[model samples]
Target: MAKFFQKNKTIHDENKLEIVSDKSPFAYVEAYKTLRTNMNFLSRNSQYKKLLLTSSIPGEGKSSVSINLARVLAENGKRVLLIDCDMRKPMLHRYLRAQRFRSRGLSTVLSGNSTLEESIATFSDLQFDLMTAGPIPPNPTELLASAEMGNLLELLETRYDYIICDTPPVSLVTDAAILSEYCDGVLLVVRQKYATFQQVKRAKQNLQNVHAQILGCVLNQYDVSKNVRESAGSAYYHYQYGDTKLASDGMMQ
Candidate 1:
């Protein structure tokens, strides 16, 4: 994995904006690879392909995790398709620096205005494709829950090894839960010191209400300086797979 990295490059292009996961430090990328490995193990015996990633609220780095996870899978030679289903605040295109193609994404395809084949933006360098949250629609929730979206995912599943979706915060809107029904499983993100126990509890409730299979939780944005002090002053990123059980403190542990 180290040999394949693009050395000396930072994980962000400018203003800590655009994604550079491929260029991230070995530890950062390794953390994501760990996530990829755990996910593979969890679904090894099952045909779980369409996975939805969501947090309890916005700004928890759910989108970031989704993008990096997809990239890691692609790096391993999987045909991965990442979709920005977070219509309310779609940022995958911006993060990927593929904004020019965001106008023809998930929303547009679900509205009967475009085809998935034509809407996706291919990132040749990353070896993965993306479907942005096309022109935030008037009713993101409705569009996602509609039959069209379900059919679209089914069709896409046949063409890709993984369909990783980044949806609106589960507690913010019903979109994540609505889309969850179509996914093989759901990965909830918990940003340390940010996401509250109450919020995550509710988010889990939302997912459970729709009978979405909870694969596990991702512990994101762990402060390496405070605890894992050795990574001070560097681009430190920590990702942990919490126990399958959802703890009362508002995270999976």
Candidate 2:
């Protein structure tokens, strides 16, 4: 519901990356809170703890959305654990500025090289814990679809109020669809002007093929300038709930 503009940079730009923090802009922070509220509303009647975030393609701001969504949930006093499942191009560690702890993460724990406790990185400032995509494995898809991945989710579900996984684009890899089986619901992140209609349609079909519960879609990097009279200079992220019909009709514009 809040609006703001990001100047001269996309959400994926490392130099001008936008993240929700205590010091973040009021509009930016409020936007994520709104998203969290919608998510809670959608899952009020169901147990939707383990959530997976993916996109139709790369650079759609799915990782950023995953991080901010997890943060907002944690801020609401929920026990949250964010995992970087995008091992092929893991960016959560860099986004969190916790590169030092990335040496041991989900990959390490799943591969039996490290214990779960040792791989999870805890931040003093954050209410939630994080699991970076530890050294990229040669078999990302295989590792994710392994029994260990399901076991890991089962264990974490007992310990945390929410376990949010940031997985690769659905159209690009089977990782998202594979992990969606272990999740309660899947939220697709669609970036404005970046994703094509066919791409989103294909992404949706891929998830459907696996029977992944598609909760909704988050419209990222939306150009608010066209919609809001005062928001003429910048673009902002918007969240939307994509029903079955909406998704089937290609939600991207």
Candidate 3:
């Protein structure tokens, strides 16, 4: 059984937590701390409960962020549920290697054919739960925007401390924008060196148009390598923090 995340945990920087490996237990601890700090900031605006993790486009590591964020929340003595709301391209289940579960998950619940409780798969520790995108529906946007989706989220609000939805990229599909309406907050993940300014602007606009609480953007896969080019096509990735020069993309802002 997986152990539950305790409160006030801390981890060192540079420790990466792998979903499939039992190694890096300390990395998990550290990852939990980093995510918990982010969660604290997120809670300031939308409460610490329901959140949607989306990106401007696909293959941007948003699913990875969602998985780790939920695990961190679970570690903090909060019952966390990570829902794979990206019906078109469900990756949360694959990343978590979540066993003891079946497919036909959120799609079923959203279509009113099943209940949220029936689809939720509890982890070994009971602190972390997972709900996969069961069958891919033809019209994911319609299902996500329906009243049943709202009802399911409302039910989760009363039970879990955190409900994280891993939805499709906003620029790739309307699924994220649709699901964001039911969530309290939306965290957009923008990959460094990949996502364009136009796509990000459109994504932010899409969420804002729906009145979704934009919790701020997360710059994933941040690299400080001297050889790497900046998102704006600059060769230099250094920033002057006080007198010391820091080699990081300005995405941290």
lDDT of 2 at 147: 96
- Per-prediction CA RMSD (Å): 7.2, 8.1, 9.7
Task: State the C-alpha lDDT per candidate.
Answer: 0.74, 0.77, 0.67
Q: Show pairs that collide, candidate 2.
A: none
Global CA lDDT of candidate 3, please?
0.67
Best by lDDT: 2
**Model 3 error, position 161 (Å):** 0.6
Please provide TM-scores, in order, for all candidate models, with all chains considered together. Answer: 0.84, 0.83, 0.75
Q: List the candidate 1 regions with Cα displacement exceeding 4 Å.
A: 1-22, 224-253
The per-residue C-alpha lDDT of model 2 at residue 115 equals: 91
**Model 2: runs farther than 4 Å from truth?**
1-15, 225-253
Per-residue C-alpha lDDT of model 3 across residues 1-253, encoded as one tens digit per residue: 2222323222212322233122334433353467678887767665757899888766566765676677667766888888888777565555445433445488988787777667877765425888888777898888899998898889988988889998877876778888888888888987787778998999999999889888778776566567753432111122122354323222221
Please give the distance, in angstroms, between residue 196's alpha carbon in candidate 1 and its true position after superposition: 1.3
Which 10 successive residues of model 1 have the least lDDT summed?
A: 244-253
The positional error of residue 34 in candidate 3, measured at the CA in angstroms, is 2.6
lDDT of 2 by residue, 1-253 (tens): 1112233222434423555665565556667788898888876889999999999976677877787788789889888999999888787777667677778898999999999888887654566788999998999999999999999999999999999999988997799999999999999988877789999999999999999999989987555544552221222322232221111111111
Worst 10 residues of 2 by lDDT: 244-253
